[model samples]
Target: MKFQAEACTTSVGGPRWERRLAIERRRAENHARRGRRTFRLSRIFSLKTAVKLFLKLSRLQARGEANARRPIIRRVSFSFPNLPTSFDGFRILHLSDFHFDGEAARAVMIRDMLRGVESDLCVLTGDYLADYFDPLGRVYCNLATVLSGVRAQYGTVGILGNNDHSEFVQRFSDLGVRMLVNDGFELGIKGESIWIAGVDDPNTFECEDVAGAMRGASSGAFKLLLAHSPEVAREAVEADVHLYVCGHTHGGQMCVPVLGPLFLNASCPRRFGSGAWRYKTMQGYTTTGLGTSAIPARFNCPPEAAIIELRRAR
Candidate 1:
């Protein structure tokens, strides 16, 4: 029931050489994806364009755009019977889906929003770049500026999302955030520890390996899984994951009031699409994320950064 530091291997995940291969592999995949009829059709008949036009006509574009910029803090607490006593009240600052463009507004807003916040650990689920083809220089710099304001005792760990390229692993790692692409490790506090397993983008890239990420995690131990999208919820549950954290749906980025999100884009159930939900004995939370995609606006669902506190249930 104890996690050994040495049990975690540095060999797995995206190594330097693996990253190079991933770049080539992903390039090929992107090329193929672009040639698909669905992809071609979507481009020809753009939903993003239609949505933008509708917003502009209704005069809600400004409001939606403002909503996208105005992110809020979400706090939620969970109690676990098997959680280590020393780790009680452990706070995890979860930020996801930056979708950072050339604009500095979102980054500055995030920095200002997290001024006095503190946490034991920080986790980032991906989609860092605003567009798949956008250069990384601006995105990386803006992300660094935002991270500079964060105050996490144990530092940050992140995984890639559908929009991110393979090179982001090394680039972000250089920024001090441990990149966990199809890899995992143990985090300890006061002699007690837990396993954190992370996978690559399962939605677009389809390269996620949950089993590989959970390689060293022992059965019945406290296991936390990080994924770009919640599509892997079933696999996580089967792998005995305790908590699954993700952000891809964006809480239906643009909702229709009472109907909720128009599209989840993830394969998981609607119940697990946003906020917190339970499956069997496992608990999970899907963040609304920090930025908008497609249309770059939010309707009822505003952007968010989460403060998740873990308490020991006695």
Candidate 2:
């Protein structure tokens, strides 16, 4: 009887042990399934977060406000003490890359920016229109009207960029912008003689003759060169230009916060992407430009018009 009881107990104990093991296995599988589900949910949440951030940035840019405020017009001022007395304290309002479309509001915004600028000369670097040809002549005509309204003591001078084709060239000329293509002209500031030279787009559709532009320039006279791309800085320096004004890189168009411009399209080093850069005796000022390109959006790098004041160095 005791042997029979022992056999029964052994059989009952074996079945209970197997049942417990099966239960533990099922619990472990359920736990693993829950972990996988949690991980998937986490990934989904992260992706949603990234999408939300992108959307927020897009909304902010479209609203024309990055930080809950209207886009502030950036005013960059620079003083060059090495300027000659003839053009002492010559203030030049430099504007570039006005990619005007049929947007009336944009024109008004640009006009507002130019409203209170008091300068001796207005120099439009290039990239005046986004249109390939003068497809929208009305837009360019309106732009010229707004540009003509700017008050400058000397006058407004402009050059043709890669974007400005024959049609734009004519329209700009009609607007009273002295379009210089591999040409040099003299301007008198306070009875002091200075040379203003401009070259056509080098990398694009125009002939760039640095030598031709500076042919008649006097060595002693203050030389200001307007070449759209800062890539010509080396040539400008070799030509012994005092100041080189350009606006092609657009400060890399888009830049990361604090880290600044990611890439500069010009041949110059990335450090020369924006603001003022000095190579030997030549000073090159590359404006961030007044418009957008490729992406039509700006972050960290804002559109700007600079006022450069030249003064004789002590």
Candidate 3:
């Protein structure tokens, strides 16, 4: 369903200047991607390129590519003491890192998975596109097709990731996904309510202000934080957020047998890399993601979309 901004109360959390700074930061990152610095500054590091080349030479690229198309529906449950009774059994459809332009089959897989899935809320943690240089028209067209399959009760909301550009905020908003940039909306049920706030890219852009994002919410409300990466876990905890959801690591994208992911690309601890973990009083879940990044492949780590059920702790 199309999410109407005015359907619920919204918090203009951060100041306009903060958003301006974030846009400028994104523009600078974009500028860095245009020249000889492109390979060095972007997600396409020499290591990832080398890994891709190795996979191609060893005939393992095809298997990894196949794995990318086969995403799993992960079911996770969390019980929170502050969670309102009305929100009990609330199912959150958490999708992230679509990288829509990467693989055509992934889109089809997502459409199939979302067919009968029902949720009270849907949150997209970002990395909607695979490459910064990809043509916007085709990329967004593919994205629109993928998003058309989503069915949620409250509606879908998203935040930007490192790979996303500033323009996508409006782009996603146009497509019925409310783009939260250091802002949020309140979901109310019979006078009981919770706040869903999202911050800008904290990993690459580093412009997130957790307290600013929680501006309009009450002190005791169950605050749900949406960030691109787990990098802001500590900040969310400091802001008194009850839950934090994000995705950027892609569950290591390419992992080994027991050693796990070779590179998480996230600043937080390894425990918070790709799944649910607790930080002080706040609980967070980082999805493995639905698509691959840097190199279009997956190893032992399969792609996934999370269906998180929130229960009020007795």
Measured on C-alpha atoms, candidate 2 has an lDDT of 0.68
What TM-score does candidate 3 get on C-alpha atoms? Answer: 0.89
Q: Write the per-residue lDDT of candidate 2 for residues 72-180, one digit (tens) a residue.
A: 4454544455566777677888888776655666666667767877878888888866654334665675576567557777767777676665344455655666777
Candidates sorted on lDDT, descending? 1, 3, 2
TM-score of each: 0.89, 0.75, 0.89
In candidate 1, what are the lDDT values of residues 29-99, reduced to their tens digit? 97678742344566657766777888889999888888898899999998889887888898989999999
lDDT of each: 0.83, 0.68, 0.83
Steric clash pairs (candidate 3): none
Off by over 4 Å in 3: 5-45, 102-105
Q: Residue 11 in candidate 2 has what lDDT?
A: 12
* lDDT value, candidate 3, whole model: 0.83
Q: Against the correct fold, how does model 2 do in TM-score?
A: 0.75
Q: After superposition, how far is residue 179 of candidate 2 from its true place, in Å?
A: 0.7
